[model samples]
Target: MALILRDIAVARGGVPVLEGVSARIETGQALILRGPNGIGKTSLLRAVAGLQPLLEGTVEPDTGQMAYGAHADGIKAQMSVAENLRFWAGLHGTSDIDAALTAFSLDGLAGRLAATLSAGQKRRVGLARLLVTGRPIWLLDEPTVSLDTASTALFGQAVDAHLRRGGTALIATHVGCGIDAPVLDLAPYKAKPRDLAGFGGNGGFA
Candidate 1:
């Protein structure tokens, strides 16, 4: 199975952001969305995840089985690391909390309160939720944020494992994440007129 996007148009806050974008993410592969800020990378990811409406075109992924990770960690302060994972696992009808914890190096911090963990730790816990969700498609936005070198490697390995099992991922980030995936630069799909006019031909509004 694959996640397919056909000439889709994405918007944010009712304003058009990206237009005429098409991509196909085959099984066991990852597609990285790269571009400057405000270029609609997040909006595109949101559209594919079914969290936002597409102004036009079609998304043919089994969106019902997709898991999305946004910029926030999404951990409740009152919840323990394990509790947080269990909550999502239950939501996804899964019981893979142990595997999730081990993947993100959170096995030792399972009993720690989410609020007490460092930024990197919290991010790890947030990422671990993806594994427990048991979803084949991962739509991640800035997933490596706050991750140190070692933690970043852990995240990459987790992604690699997911792909090995016939999973697919679409990642939006400014920095590369060590995944040997084709880079889809969102700049080319940016909405016309305003994007060119607002940026003064330099692709940035300065």
Candidate 2:
């Protein structure tokens, strides 16, 4: 299964953000969205995840089962660490909290308030949601945000494992995460005037 984009275009605040961008990510590979700030890296990710409205174009993945994690970690501050994971997994109808926390090194903090965790700790908790839910495609925005070298390495290992298991991922990051994947920059594709009715790209590799 693959995710394909065809002649996609997007506009925000009445300005074109991405135009004619095209790429196809497959079942066992990863794709990186690289660009300067305001070039629509995050916007592109959101569009791919179906979280944002596309002005023009299309996003078609061979399958609909997916995972999307943003830079914010999206952990609820008022909830316990495990409680937060429970809430996220609940969205996917998952009930295995122990295994989920264990996989992310979060079992020890199960009862700890997520608000009391450090920035790096919180990022782990957020990433754990993806693992626990067991989605096939992962759309991650800055998966290593606020992490130290060790934490970053841990995150890297997790992603590597995910790829090894044939889970596709689309990641947006300014800082490199030691994972090897094909890269796509939006600017070159966006230089031309666009229709901005939707966003997508068409690409093929043989």
Candidate 3:
């Protein structure tokens, strides 16, 4: 199924971050989200992944086929590289770990503890989990962070393969990951400030 986001308004702590954002991504296509910091790119990704509440509008996708990878690597430091991948694969009801390891060039570090890997290596391992998730839609937030040039190219290849297999990706990145995709600039959708009297607690705005 394709992902359709229409007139979406997103907020963080009751303060709006993105307003009137609309985009559509068909299967086998990639949509690269572009905007400066604090423009609500991450919020939009989270909204699509069902991790954040949408203040307005709708997103149509088969929830069961969606996967989200945020700024955090989500890898356990105490676990081995392969162990971490296997854990995620099992969680997603899959066991094909070899493909993921090979996809990210993680085969060599499969037995290495995550605690000892370099930043780029860890990022690679984190991205590899997407392959084993068996999901068709990827919501990636700053996915290329800390990746070296070679690793970045590897990541791009993985996305290319995914799209070729009829999977869709909504990527939020500040750097070019080499994916030739349509750009979805979130700048025009930036939220205007509103009265915060009703917003409880911090009322933090992105």
Candidate 4:
């Protein structure tokens, strides 16, 4: 399995959030985590990416082979588009950044600082980082949030290509994301809404 989460359980300050979450995502597949606001969608993605600990589960990943893009974009405002790619490319041990910059329509923004670009442009910069990782598993949280229609399509195309190349993905987003992937809704697995910080006591969405 490219990514696997089994018997996953999470609690915050003694309140349960997710329970008995299990899934296996193999190469050439995508898993879409769809849920209302809060309800641990982002938390689940974070845990899968090893950013957050799994309270009661196991996540086995192929080391140095994943990219995590959060809803916030995680772009450095002071750096230009090319500059940002250069930094991440270097960090990921990549020797090329030009192809990534061009893929995200950032060639023209190479001279402009990230702070000066619009939200969509910043998102492109953030997504461009994926090109440097060369990882097979991509963990994306609301990756299309700040993107325009064109950019969203562009991102989707990138994902499709990745899947074609035997890559895997786990995405957390409310929208369809327009990718072919199994969707796991936390609503049913989460017995009660009030079990977590983001869920109401009635097992209702946040």
Per-model TM-score versus the true fold? 0.92, 0.87, 0.93, 0.87
Model 2 lDDT, full chain set: 0.77
Question: Which residue pairs show backbone clashes in model 4?
Answer: 16-195, 193-200, 193-203, 194-200, 194-201
lDDT, each prediction: 0.87, 0.77, 0.87, 0.78
For model 4, what is the error of residue 108's alpha carbon versus the real structure, in angstroms, after optimal superposition? 1.7
Which residue window of length 10 is worst by lDDT in model 1? 197-206
RMSD to native for every prediction?
A: 5.6, 4.6, 3.7, 5.2
- Where in model 3 is the C-alpha error above 4 Å? 195-206
- Candidate 4 global Cα RMSD: 5.2
Compared with the true structure, what per-residue lDDT tens digits does model 3 show for residues 103-191? 89999999999999998898999999999999999999999999988889999999999999999999999889989998988898887
Off by over 4 Å in 4: 12-14, 191-206
Q: Pairing residues by index, what is the TM-score of model 2?
A: 0.87
lDDT of 1 at 133: 93
The stretch of ten residues in a row with the least summed lDDT in candidate 4 is: 197-206
Is candidate 3 or 4 superior in TM-score?
A: 3
Residue 144 of candidate 4: its Cα lDDT?
90
- Model 1 ranges with Cα > 4 A deviation: 194-206
- Best by the lDDT measure: 1
